[model samples]
Target: MPAGQWSSAQGASTSTSDLSGRYGNGRPRGQALIVILAVLAGVSGVAWLIWVTGFHGRPLAQSGLTAYEIVDDHRATATLTVTRRNSGVVANCLLRAYAEDHTTVGELNFTLDGSDPKRVDLTKSVRTEREATSVELVGCTADGQPRPR
Candidate 1:
């Protein structure tokens, strides 16, 4: 095109200016992309926190252990007794007692037939009465099968 013909055509486009345009110190494309990614990351983090922590705090257990008698702060020894159920030959019956902070203070190991009511004594293993705080009895097979909870 000739220069004079191009000058005449440009006059018509001069009136079609963008109204909302202003001089701006624009943010770089990298910075804008980083801000967009940060926003998305924050939203996803909140969603994951909500999904992991449900209505209840504890995990879903198939069967909770039946807590029998909770003996705490007993003199010289703490003891927890549960009704002994008749299983096969109970090779090992252990009454493991702990302190208030779940520290193993004493353990009384004994062999008892599941058919009869037996008492496991922690007094023999417990040297100090002050250390005995919380007690729990766990019976298990010698082969590692956890006794019926």
Candidate 2:
């Protein structure tokens, strides 16, 4: 009840709000350091959370290739799984086929309706000079840019 002095429910006594007052100064250097570190940690944690969820709060899209099978030298089948984290955003992916030498032999661009758990089984046919050994879903974009990397 007194300025710069109080007692806790456990009958503990203090001359100031700061425990460092026992050391005969306003507050000890270590107390200041601890306060600084605590503030810094709290601020950094908030900033990190903001940075991580910044894109998540916006209209974004992601997609993955769940399964693929080579039907022939010129055709392949794949399962595309697209996730539209934001509403009203349509996404598209570029499916690519590679030859035995890891060269891009064929590619196809496909679109999605941007619905929840969006998935489709698609057949990608590419006329390659050689046999395709593998297929991959390069990437998906909300803007319908089907650039397969």
Candidate 3:
């Protein structure tokens, strides 16, 4: 019946004793649980960020298509620039040629030996069933390493 005073269902004025009876240590309930959950979420988020940026961010090897030429029917050529984190390790790359209809017409598998530099441009030719309109590097992976996705 008075301002700043809480009442119970039975019309009894609630006091600190009532609060202490409902919540242990005379503190509000759920506060500790909320803080604990917040800390756990923050820790989990930081762990995920570290895993993503430190472990899974960059690829072991990368390849880019520098140039491509449709030599003629049944033949195509591609120039690729390959870069690897470890130049002393061997790497493999796959290049594909596509027709005007977007169908894969040819594919070539090439190797980068340890003697090669960390970054190098390679020119290779592919034998296709028909004429190819364009060529691209499908992927590259270091020896004993997982293939790029």
The most accurate candidate by lDDT is 3
lDDT of 1 by residue, 115-142 (tens): 6443332232334244566555564333
lDDT at 108, model 1: 61
Q: Give the TM-score of candidate 1.
A: 0.33
lDDT of 3 by residue, 1-149 (tens): 77877757655767887877778673356887888899999999999999878755666688888888899999998887898877787888898999999999999988888888998888899999999998888878875557652
**Clash tally, candidates in order:** 0, 0, 0
lDDT string, candidate 2, 95-139, tens digits? 788988888988887766645454444445545555788888887
Worst lDDT run of 10 residues, candidate 2, spans 114-123
Candidate 3 segments exceeding 4 Å error: 1-14, 19-34, 143-149
> Which stretches of model 2 miss by more than 4 angstroms?
1-38, 50-59, 113-121, 143-149
Decoy 2 TM-score against native: 0.55
Top TM-score hit:
3
The lDDT per prediction is: 0.48, 0.69, 0.84
Q: All candidates' TM-scores?
A: 0.33, 0.55, 0.76
Clash count (model 3, backbone only): 0
lDDT of 1: 0.48
